[model samples]
Target chain A: MPEVSFVESLRMTLREEMQKDPLVMLIGEDIGRYGGIFGVTKGLLEEFGPYRVRNTPISESAIIGSALGAAMTGIRTIAEIMYIDFTTCAMDQIVNQVAKIRYMSGGKMKIPLVIRTQCGGGRGNAAQHSQSLEALFFHIPGLKVVMPSTPYDARGLLKASIHDDNPVIFIEHKLLYATKGYVPEEEYIIPLGQAEIKKKGREVTIITFSYMVWKTLRAAQQLEKEGVDVEVVDLRTLYPLDLETILQSVRKTNRALIVHEGCRRNGIGAEIACRIQEEAFDYLDAPVERVAAMDVPIPYSEPLEKAVIPDEEDIIQGVKRVLSRN
Target chain B: MKEDHQIWLELYRMMVKIRRFETLTGELFAAGKIPGFIHLSIGQEASSVGVCSTLRPEDYITTTHRGHGHVIAKGGDVKRMFAELMGRSTGYCKGKGGSMHIADFSLGILGANGVVAGGFPIIVGAGLSIKLRGTDQVAVCFFGDGASNRGPFHEALNMASIWKLPILFVCENNQFASTTSFHYSTSVKSVAQRSIAYGIPGRSVDGNDILEVREAALEAVERARKGEGPTLIENRTYRLRGHFEGDPQRYRTKEEVENFLEKDPIKRFQEFLKNEKILNEEMDRQIWQAIDSELTDAIRFAEKSPYPQPMEALRDLYAEDVDPLFQRSLA
Candidate 1:
């Protein structure tokens, strides 16, 4: 077993995948000689050469559109948008073209494409750079959105997404890139849409994903000492949500709390909470609760940014609120 | 003649076929047989047939909303295309994609994009794929003058130029982008001249002349095959029909359309074929008859084809098995 940082795990997987399959190519801004802005694709260009590790111009639409074209035409592509906020520049290509091409073509086209981007509010990067937009992509029917919380999850889920013969939006958190976790040296793939129960308990179920998973896990540990048992379920994939796992956890605990780093309004929590109520309403001993970022533009100030996004305290309070409903 | 008489007649036949297909499509839409809207390249047959004449079946092309001529020229099956237009299950996209999104991957025709300049970037990817695969397959992107104003067009051109991707950007400057005239909407006087900004060779051609379009496309396609890079070609033509069927067309006058009717590509190619002795009235009549019968059978096939079940909408949305969550949410 090897303990690797989230960014290292991603780089290792990309290198291994590129070595295994020549068709697997990386394209984005500064992904080649400059590596990536987050250093996730560092040294990959030197390893794979220029053609496979392409450095693209600041053309988001072209970056995504070319990825779509190349993927369908027998080249698997990993298109990197430097930031999730910038994805709006190429919204038509991502939403109209990449997402719908397979279905629109009657399943005649195979889009082995991965759009890797990062989003969160902890970086103090302000409104344009720090907002989480997984909800927008999740709303698209044809795309698969995966947001991993740990190095282990990131490595395994990325491998599955790249090989999945469909378009995948592989979302990463900027804050979690340096976080280290145990990863086995042997190759193993974590299937998308499969939720992992990070910590199991019986009192309350805390369901979250991406960076929120870490905060929820810590809250669960503290709640254990406070005589309140808590369960944590990390939903690695957002679109084809692991409803079964979520429902099972909620059914077992008879209480549910959804947490995410995105805005509370129409965020990932809204959909997850709705699904829980729809599926496990009878099993729930209390109403479902959600802890999410405030519905405001992420400010550049550190205190304001921290206050806007959900934290461990928010998750802890959300758990107490759900438990108090009984 | 360097080219055979049969090749000349074949090009004329393709142009006529596109002309007939577009005319029939317009008629059917007016007759209320077709569902959804359609954009026709009624007067741009020479640009499509001429450029496509230089491409192999394995080469790639990404077209625009006004893409029927390009698709037909690129060897798309008329029966499946008509079936798709009629929203039949036997169509190219199983009725999911209509006239604006028809695609035939077997013939290397990437789907026609519904967006104005959506195909530019996608065709760049196709060219990159060709280079990676180590093949000489060039990718042609067919767009309108209006599309040149889009961000993707600029981005795609810059990328294709730097990478030296095997791409042919055929701009069908039909003088209009829907209601807005190309002259008013485009900043440049000619779309071809803008190519110098991206360091690519470009030229404008008389889009009504099939020989001229074909000769320019031949040289460009050769450059792409030899890994030289992309070329921008502005085909100066006119949209004989309105942007879409049933358009009020208040933007342009009837006299304006009638003026371009004299310069119709199909008619011009027919005259050239007649002068070259490659075709006569009888041969032209036979070609039309053959195409007409084929279109008639396609209509019959589409009419007989079953409409997809409502639940079938959920199918093919994903390459993987339909997620239970998807079904639950829809339910």
Candidate 2:
């Protein structure tokens, strides 16, 4: 096994998929020669050439709509919207066209497309470039949402997403791109909607995903020294949420703490917390606590941005609050 | 520029078919046989028929909300289209998508979009698919003057030009965006003029003249198939009917509507055929009678077809098996 950065794992997976299937291609702005804004597609243009790795204009609507069209026409396309926040510019295409085409067409058409975009804030890119909008896409049907926390999960899940017959919104955390993780050299796939236990404990269950998964894990490690055991569940796929794993964890631990970087109001955590309470009402020893970003536009200053988004301290506090009931 | 009599006759027949079908559709909607509001292209027959006549069955096309003419010209089955509008199980979308969303993938009709300018970017992708597959087939996009001002229109044109993709953008400048005239809404004088900003060949034609529209379409289609990239042709025409069914004509005067009706493409094409000695009163009557009988059969088919089962609403949401939760509930 070799260690690889999250972005490197993505590039390696893209290269492998493109080589394995001719129908798989990429279309985005500055992806070809510029190798992508996040460098996730650094050498793909040179390796795959311009035909397969297409650089489109600064047109988010066309970028996504064209990908939807191409996918319907028998090409599996991976389109990159530079940032998830910019996805608002092409909301109609994503919400109305891509998400509803299969259903509206009565399954006569299949849109095998993956919209890859970066989300999260930690480098002070401000509100525009940094937003965790998984909640928006997860709300729509006919779309599969995947957010990977590790390079191994990123490579495996993206490979699975490329082969999926439906439309997928593959979200990458900008802060996690450079983080290194152990990835297998052999070809493998981690099926979507499967949760991975980063750390096992029985005192409390901390269910999170994306960059927040790492924060929760670090907090769990810190809590171990204080004799408080915490189980951290990384939800790799958000839409077809692996509630089975979440419910089981809650049933055993009897306490649930859902953490995410998105705002708490109507966030993904709210939905998960509701489900946990609904299914494991008898097992829960306390109410499900949620620690999410404050409901405000992320500020440009580093200190203010850090203050707004949830950190390891927030996760630790949330865990202690939930464990206090027992 | 001598025209082939047989081709001219066929074009005339298609134009008449489109005209008669739309007229009957308007009646059906008025009688409450159709469920949703429909946008008719009653006066823009020549542009749709003329352009589509030059396309191969393998080529693809994307249409606007007012897309009945385009569907018919592209060889869509009239019975299925009627069934679609009637919300029957036999429709192209199995009643899920009504008039503005009918699609026939087998005939390469990408779809009819309800959103203005939605087809612009979609056609660009179709063109790119053609290029990647190494096919010479072209993609045609039918949009109105209102769609020309949209962001996707500019993005698609620019992308198509830089990539040298095979696409033909046919802008039906019908002089109205709902109630606002193109003259008031659009900054440029002609929709074709905007194409020059993207460095593509652009031309304007008298859309009511079937021959001119066909000739322009032929040139553009040829350029696309040869990998010469996209061309924008603005078909200067008029909307004979209100924007949609039940649209009060308070926005425009009755006199203005009468002036546009005078240049109805079907009527002009009939006169052109007669002047060329290819059609006479007898031939014209025979054509109208055949179209009437065909439309009668289509209406019957729609009326007789059953509505989709209520349970079918849950089906077709995903090609793969949906989560067991949805499956169990639907089951």
Candidate 3:
């Protein structure tokens, strides 16, 4: 199998889905002839026709609302918000309509809708376009959150999310689009709510997901060089989090450090920390340390951005602190 | 609009069904058997029945908070609708959607929306799908005078007009949006007047007269099916009941309600049918008996149905394919 970039994988998944299901459709701003801001949807309008790959007006509420309506009426729709920050404009539709419809309707309704948006601050997109909001979605009960860290997982998960019966909030990292991983050209699926253990270790376990997964893995490699042998766990799905896997890892290592790109205050790390403290506290040798981006907006300046966001060195330091505490 | 014997008789049957359904629903709400707020389509039944009667079974409809009458006219199952209001597992939305949001997709009654003007954009999307699939299906959106001001309503109508989407926007101007009279709320004298801005044909009809409402809705739907874009039908009617079950009509007068009731759609239909010699006592009795039994049975089914399990609440928020989904993906 040839290595495929994450962006290419997403494009292929969309192509395959569009070809298979006549009801499958795409809608977003500049998604038609413009091929999307990221070019992941290049040539879709020409290949599938404009109707199937529509370019919607710049109305997030309408974009999300229309997608909800279309999905309710038998069209399997994938609506894209250009950036994660803009989803705030459509919070009511996303949280109330999309998240609550199935439960509020007693499961008689199916919203086969996928809302794909990008998150990250490395490019100095600053506060508006850079914050990770997976925790906010994870707080909602009905929505499933997918944040893939690799090209293989991104492609496989996008295909799976498209066909899933529920509404999926798929978050793509701005930094990972160009990243490449070995992906089969043919059909595949990466199951949601399953964590992948990136590097096996007997020392403290590092529970992380999304763009921070790679950061922690690099940190783990450095930790191993220092004889710490830190285990790095990547949680592929955030909503129905694989608590069992995380618990098992914690039981084995008896020490842990949770990491996320989202700000630390009331972030996903807090929830994961609370869960660990509850389920595996007796087995742990030290309190769980969390390595998250400091609780603030991502800055425009490179050094300021680095200070606010967590990197491999920060993950390495977090591991050392957890090990010393043990 | 004067109707012949047959049309009057049909109108009487529909109006009675709507009136009886709402009366029963109001009673259920008072009895605490129904959860969530109820927006009755009581006095405005003519608008729902009239326009819905014009639609083919395959043609689509999107409705508003006050949606029961429209659903009934579009052939939704009465028992399932009731069951849904009671939060039973057998309801139209499997007990998820209550009074304000009941729907039966098989009958082409897309779910009634809770948000003001929320149905417009969705109706446009549905219309787009219809056009794309090369189906002659025309989608009708029955909203209220209040929804005319919503941004989505304007966006949807403009897009529909430009694309010539097969849609009929039926604005049931029932005078008040929860006690806020249209006169005080809307800037335009007539809701249909707004259509000129979108470049779609516009018309106003006596919503109290089912025949008039039917004729207008039908003409607009026909035009849409002919690939002529959307039409705005402002059916001027009045709200017979308070906005929801518990609203005290401190905003309106008893004289106003009485005045609207004198021209009640059901009574009007009955008079028209009797004068035209189409209504017999036997036909009246049969229609009442049929609707009554349906209502009674539907209530029973809803009462007997189970409440949803707590765990099932986790399902259906997102579409899924081969992935194990949130549990595994997060793991």
Per-candidate clash tally: 0, 0, 35
lDDT of 2 by residue, A155-265 (tens): 999998998888999999998999999998889999978999888999889999999988888888898989999999999999778889898899999999999999889
lDDT of 1 at B26: 92
Model 2 chain A: ten consecutive residues of lowest lDDT: A101-110
lDDT, candidate 3, equals: 0.84
Q: What would the per-residue lDDT of candidate 3 be over residues A245-298, giving only the tens digit for each residue?
A: 899999999998998889899998898898999988899999998888888888
* Candidate that scores best on DockQ: 1
Candidate 2: residue B6 lDDT (0-100): 88
Please give the fraction of native interface contacts (Cα pairs under 8 Å between A and B) kept by each candidate: 0.79, 0.64, 0.50
* Tens-digit per-residue lDDT, B129-235, candidate 2: 88888999999999999999889999999999999989999999999998888999999999999988999999999999999999999999999999999999999
Clashing pairs in 2: none
The TM-score of the first chain in every model comes to: 0.98, 0.98, 0.98
CA lDDT, candidate 3, residue B154: 79
Q: What local lDDT score does residue A70 receive in model 2, on the 0 to 100 scale?
A: 91
Assess each model's interface with DockQ, reporting 2 decimals per model.
0.78, 0.69, 0.40
* Cα lDDT computed for each candidate against the true fold: 0.91, 0.91, 0.84
